[model samples]
Target: MSVRIGFIGVGGIAQSHLSGLLTLPEAEIVALCDISRQQVEKAVERFNKEAVGKEPAGRKLEAAIYDDYRQMLRREKLEAVFICLPPFVHGEVEEAVIEASLPFLVEKPVALSLSLAGKILDGVLKKELITTVGYQLRCGSFMDKARAALAGKTVAAIVANRFGRTPGVSWYHRQDKSGGQLVEQATHQVDMLRYLVGEVDTVYAAAATRINNKDNPEYDIFDSNCMTMTFACGAVGNFGNGTMAHVGVPPGLNGVHIFGDNVQVTIGGNLRIATPDGVTEEPLDKDMMVRQDSAFLKAVAENDPTLIRSDYLSGVRTLAVTLAGEKSARTGQPVKVADLLAAEAPAAL
Candidate 1:
């Protein structure tokens, strides 16, 4: 029997997951919901065309569309759900999903508000639902090698940077909406830093709006961010990102590097490791997002939660770490992640 799925948001990120789910024979996307009904319809048309010859013979895509997610949740007999909403619009959808006792996969930087995220995490834990986050990089084959390379070795520091053009999406330019590049885009690195090194204890950051805002007057998010972090295990990290590049000009440099006891790891388009003994390189064999989708579907089918790497709590922690940096940048003082997570109380859900 195929695992039935419903999507709560049908935006660009949702389509990324949709592309992966369309390849699986056991996955069936039964419903899609978004504020714009037409957006859902268009996504259906796009993916259905891609599903040609992939589905069972003569099985037409009849996925229902909706502008209201609550109605879709009540009406559909879904086995699982994918909440692919933006940073600012996550809490309510997740609460409803948990209330319905359905397993779900939510995209990362889970929510802009830490209190709400913590509340959702608490509810999820109470229900013991199988949940996964969209940090697909963790599903990469190259990541396996990176983890293996660090076995028994301590990671001392992680240094990473990302330079790119402003995303075409309008919400990304608003700090209140997207929380700048650190919270929105470079969050994958923050999550990976935690996965590989350790939990960040403190964050100090500085940022400026150099260029993007000048051209796009309404742009409120900073174009550049530089951050420093101290980890629970005494490891450290320096990460920076900027959104000032031209559309056609490539940043020419992006990725993370880890330094440790006799080990150096580089993760970019591929994975590279150097030790006193030798150097190893691993290239990804498939799309990590697709792999993540496959793993989540399997977890749902078999009721096995261990198959997922980044669970809901992990996503919440990552959001806290990134938001701590944002707060530090604004205040010019180091922000402890624990302090940030503790200051917020769960709002009425």
Candidate 2:
């Protein structure tokens, strides 16, 4: 049986999810929710244009647009929903999904603040609903190879550097809205580090807003930040992020380099795996997001939690690490992940 999917916050990322879902035969988008009527209409028109040449005569595209997600959820009998809204809006949507006993896939960072992230976690625990987060990089073939290459070996240190154009989203400039680049974009690298290595125990960070003045006046959020993390496994990690790279550089140049006892692995847009025996370069595959979508659909079809690549708990742990780094940056002191999580009680769902 096909799974009916509803999407909340029909924006650029929602469009990407729609594109990914179109590739899965067992998944069908039945409804879309966005605040702007124009955006909803535009999305419908675009989908119609794309479907005209492909779908069979009788298999018409079936989707209704909504301005309020609660109304969409109330009116549509959907098997699953994808929360593609901004970070600040995620907590409430997730709580509603859990209460409705519907499976959901939320985009990264989970929530804009630690308190909301905790709340989402509590709701998930209470509802015991199937959940996944958008950490698509974990589905990359190169990342898997990199993880295997580092397993069982003592990781001495990890270094990640990410540089790119300033985020085009309006919320990118507001810390309360988007959680800045550390939580918004750099969280991917941070999560990868923890996935490849182990749980992060503490973080020390420094940050500055040296550039992107035109786009980010007041500069409440940092344009660049550096963090050092201590993992429970005794390995240390250093990560740097900058939104001020020259315009000539590609949109995103992000990579993780792992130093281990036997092999050193670096994976990003390009892949390089090195060991004592030899060095090999793995070709970058462009199908990571496609594979991620396929995995999520497979999980939904089977109703098996293990099939989901990044579950809700894993996403929360990663969010905690990223948020810890943010706290460290702001306070000029080292922050512990456990303390951060403990300080904020989950929202009452």
Estimate candidate 2's alpha-carbon lDDT, on a 0 to 1 scale. 0.82
Off by over 4 Å in 1: 53-60, 247-252, 345-349
Model 2 misplaced stretches (Cα beyond 4 Å): 54-61, 214-218, 248-253, 345-349
Give residue 177's lDDT in candidate 1 (0 to 100): 89
Local lDDT at 62 for model 1 = 70
lDDT of candidate 2 over 256-285, digit per residue (tens): 888999888888767888899999996778
Over the stretch 1-349, how does candidate 1's per-residue lDDT look in tens digits? 5789999988999987777776677889899889989887877777677668766532445788889999999999999999998888888899999999999999888888788888898899999999999999999888888888888898888889888888887688998889789999999999988888878999999999978877678898888899999999898889988888676434425788999999999887668899999997777557899888889889989999999999898888898988998899999999989887777633211
The predictions' CA RMSDs to the true structure, in order, are 2.6, 2.8
Q: Report, for all candidates in order, the number of backbone clashes.
A: 0, 1
TM-scores, each model vs. reference: 0.94, 0.93
Using lDDT, give the best candidate's number.
1
Q: Write down the lDDT of every candidate, Cα atoms only.
A: 0.86, 0.82
